[model samples]
Target chain A: MATATVILLDGLAYGMVLFIISVGLTVTMGLMRVVNLAHGGFAMAGGYLAAMMIRAGVPFFAAAALATLAAGILGGIAEMTVFRPLYRKGELAQVLMTFGLTFVFIAALTWLFGTDVKILPIPSYLAGPVDLGFRTYPTYRLFLIVVGLLLFLLVWFVIEGSLYGARLRAAVDNPRMARAVGIDVNRLFTITFVIGCALAGFGGVIGAEMLQLDPFYALRYLVLFLVVVAVGGLGSFKGSFVAAITLGVVETAGKFLFTDIAAFLLFALVFVLLLWRPNGLLPPKSVA
Target chain B: MNPAWHALPWLLAIAFYFTAGGYLSLGTSILVYILLTLSLDLALGYAGIITLGHAAFFGFGAYGAALFAIHVNADPLLGLVVATAVTAVFAVVTGMLILHTQGVTLLMLTLAIAVLLAEAANRAYKVTGGDDGLQFTMGPVLGLFRFDLWGQTAYLYTLVILFVWFVIAWKVVHSPFGRSLDGIRQSQARMRAIGTPVWWRLIAIYAISAAMAGSAGALSAQTTRFVGLNTLGLLVSGIAVVMLVLGGTRRLYGAFLGAAVYVVVQDFAAKVNPFYWMFVIGGLLMATVLFLEGGLMEVLDIGRRWLRRLLRGSDPT
Candidate 1:
């Protein structure tokens, strides 16, 4: 019973991080119609940057902030350069180009980083454990839960309440009409991509302690990340939130329960979900 | 000018080059790769099926051949035949279910299928030898000729197989059935409207291509005497697509040209600087995508057309 509780919390914590990272991907794919294989690259860059800064004696929060900013910059540049050209092309070109960029990023990073698994230490402030009546959970893990909730609410408020969010909503619904209404569609797209990358960067900082800072980790975890996005559906925030948490818990618990069959089962779920919904669990079909 | 007299000297020179250069093994590998690339051309270039899991069929063939050889002690010819048959069956089953999805969905599904098979191979330690990979001591060829490590015998075998496959592929490409495939490529909706069974045709093409890929794999395993997980890895599948694109899609000889360029560049570049080969490949792809709109074949065609014009200078009809 205690083991079950522990697994549930652990899964939730992991799932929250996946949620944060994949929400950005879901949004970009929803608005831009580009399958950014380099989305994981942004997470990687942020994790690496945060690790380097932490090793250099910078505070974790400050390092994380800088990493998020760096990711946003990289995302903006990718939008302007690689993605802009493929907007008018087919989905195959978009997938291929992004895949090409992914290889380039992996090769370049491997060349620089020497393939070793780089570690990030858990910050002192968030170190130790909290006693729950039956079991003790890591304090840092609890902190991530709190942080994750805050981020969820913040994103929800901004997306539902703010003017920029309204413009974004308009763009997601109909780009032509949004442009006709004098919204700078390109600028919104750039901002959205940057914001999505920045969220992935934040997820990286919190999630880095769990995942090793390695070159191929991005490729290794890419399918799962995509699974979260696809199961949640594009442009549907609520769907991503629910799907991400569900997948995180299921996958984490699956490894424990199913053992060797975890990966197959996880992928099978993705296939089944896609088959059922064609687009996703909850496609953005209302406004459009 | 007598035709026999004109071609006889060139044929003798070609024979001399093939004999002197020990070009058999290298030439055969090129031919096998040409077949693999042609199979990819049908799916990627013609059908717009952006598959990144093509190595699934290749690995399937390798394993299939090994299974046949180990259990039945089958002849090498029979091994390849069985391998192709198995791969075609697998392709049909998977392609029918997966090919209905378009774009990233299809890519992801294909990738998942490849990863599933690869992981299964990894976990089944006793059967596949797990991470160490599978090994087979191939029996005599066609129950007659013995296996030779020397380049000459191996090269001729592969070259002949390639030539035969090329002839068949050329016939298929030029036929009315192939033209129907072109129509499907342009628009599935229009083809469906015209009463073309788009889905079944796609499944058929995918199965045929998988069979060809499987043959390449069987031949490769037989010649090399070893097969690794990397044969089914993303890198091989990615490179095959890259080669096809570099050579230009929908062009017959383009697959051969692409494979030659890809293999030669990898071999040469690794010798020169192993670390920078990927950078070179990426740069080349970018250049091709940005500048060579129609791929390397288009550039060559333009050059040839220019040369012809220059040779026929001032001649007006």
Candidate 2:
């Protein structure tokens, strides 16, 4: 029972990180239909920047904020340039182009940081254990859960409860109609893309302890992000949340109970879940 | 192409053997990669099955062939046949599972299957030799020619097999069934409306492609006498796609050009600096998508047209 509780908490924290990173990809592929395979590269960029700042004696929160802002600026520049041309191309072209972009990011990071895994140490406030009523749990994980839940709430409200979000949804549902209504769908998408990449950057800053930062960070964890988005039904935020948590728990449990086949079982779950859901657990209303 | 054109590549291969003597093993690898890329074209270029899991079939074939050599038989031909059969069976099962989904869902399914197989191969260290890799000695080809250090026999044997497969691929690509596959790729709904068995055709072509990839994998194992976990890695799959795109899809000859350039360039670049190759490959991929849509073959076509115009200098019309 004790072990199960510990696994559940760890899994939740891991899932929260996945959700944050994958939500960006969900926006790009699901809402925008661009199939940007380099989304993880942005996350890696943020994490790497934050790592450098912290190593140079910047405070943890300040480092994360600067990294996120820089990542957003980078996204904005990418949008106005290379990615702008790709919005009109086919998925295959997008895939190949973004794959090239990813390779470039990996190569760049390797040159800058060397091939070794880079560490991002959490601040003392969030480090060590905290006493719960029943048992002691890591303060860092509790912070992750709090941050994930808060972000989910904020994102849900912005996307579902605000006029801007309604316009964003309108653009996604039918770009022509949105354009006809003078929505400036292109601008809306650019904003969303920038915000999504920034969130991915923030996720990287906080989740570095779990996912680990390396030159190959983008490629190594790409499938996980894609799986979460696919299982969540692409454009659906709520489904991403649920699917991320479920997969995280399943992966964590597999590691705890069947260490020898942990990765195999995780992949097997992906296969079966996808077979069962196809479009995912909760496809967006337009798709449904 | 004219009947005489069939022997051009073979002639080059032979000439290369005498000229580049010590580099015959590298030449052998180029041939093996060409066959693998050719097989990918059948499913991806011809059938339009968007996937990144082709390496699963190739790696499984290597494992299958290596285990066959270790336990049951040491004859290279028999191992190749066994490996092909095993991989084809595996493809049939996975194709059924993954082909039902479309687009992103489909892509993820294929990736999942590949990762699952790789993980299984990793854990079964006793059988696959895991990270240390599976190594074995291959018997003489057809029980007559002995395996040599200079790779003289390996190059010729691989060239012969590649030629046979290339001919078979040519027939398949030009056949009526191949025409139907073109239809499906262009308009799946139209093909379905016209009563074409879309799903079955996909599975069949996937199996055939898997068989070819398996044979290539088996050949690689036999020639190199080793099968490492990296054989099943995403890098191998990605590199295969890179080669296919570099040459141009739907043209079988493209595989030959792409694989040769990729292998030779990688060999040279790695010697200079390992990371330098990534920049070159990545830049090439971007250039191919952005400006060179039809790849190197398209450039060659344009060059030939220019040459024709140059020959008819006086004809303004």
Q: CA lDDT, every prediction?
A: 0.78, 0.88
Residue-wise lDDT of candidate 2 within B1-317, one digit each (tens)? 45655676678888998998678899999999999999999998898888888889999899999999999999988899999999999999999888866788888888888898899999999989989998899999999997798988888888988888888888888998899989988889999999999999889889989999998988898899999998898887888888988888888888887898889887887788788777677878888888887877888778867877897886777
Question: lDDT tens string, model 1, A220-254?
Answer: 77777777877777777777887888887787888
Please compute DockQ, using alpha carbons, for every candidate against the native two-chain complex. 0.43, 0.80
| Candidate 2 TM-score over all chains jointly | 0.97
> Which stretch of 10 consecutive residues in model 2 chain A shows the poorest summed lDDT?
A87-96
DockQ of 1: 0.43
TM for every model, in the order presented, reads 0.91, 0.97
Residue A212 lDDT in model 1? Answer: 63
Candidate 1 regions exceeding 4 Å error are A286-288, B1-29, B314-317
lDDT at residue B205 of model 1 (Cα atoms): 85
Best by TM-score: 2
Docking class of 2: medium
| Candidate RMSDs in order | 3.5, 1.8
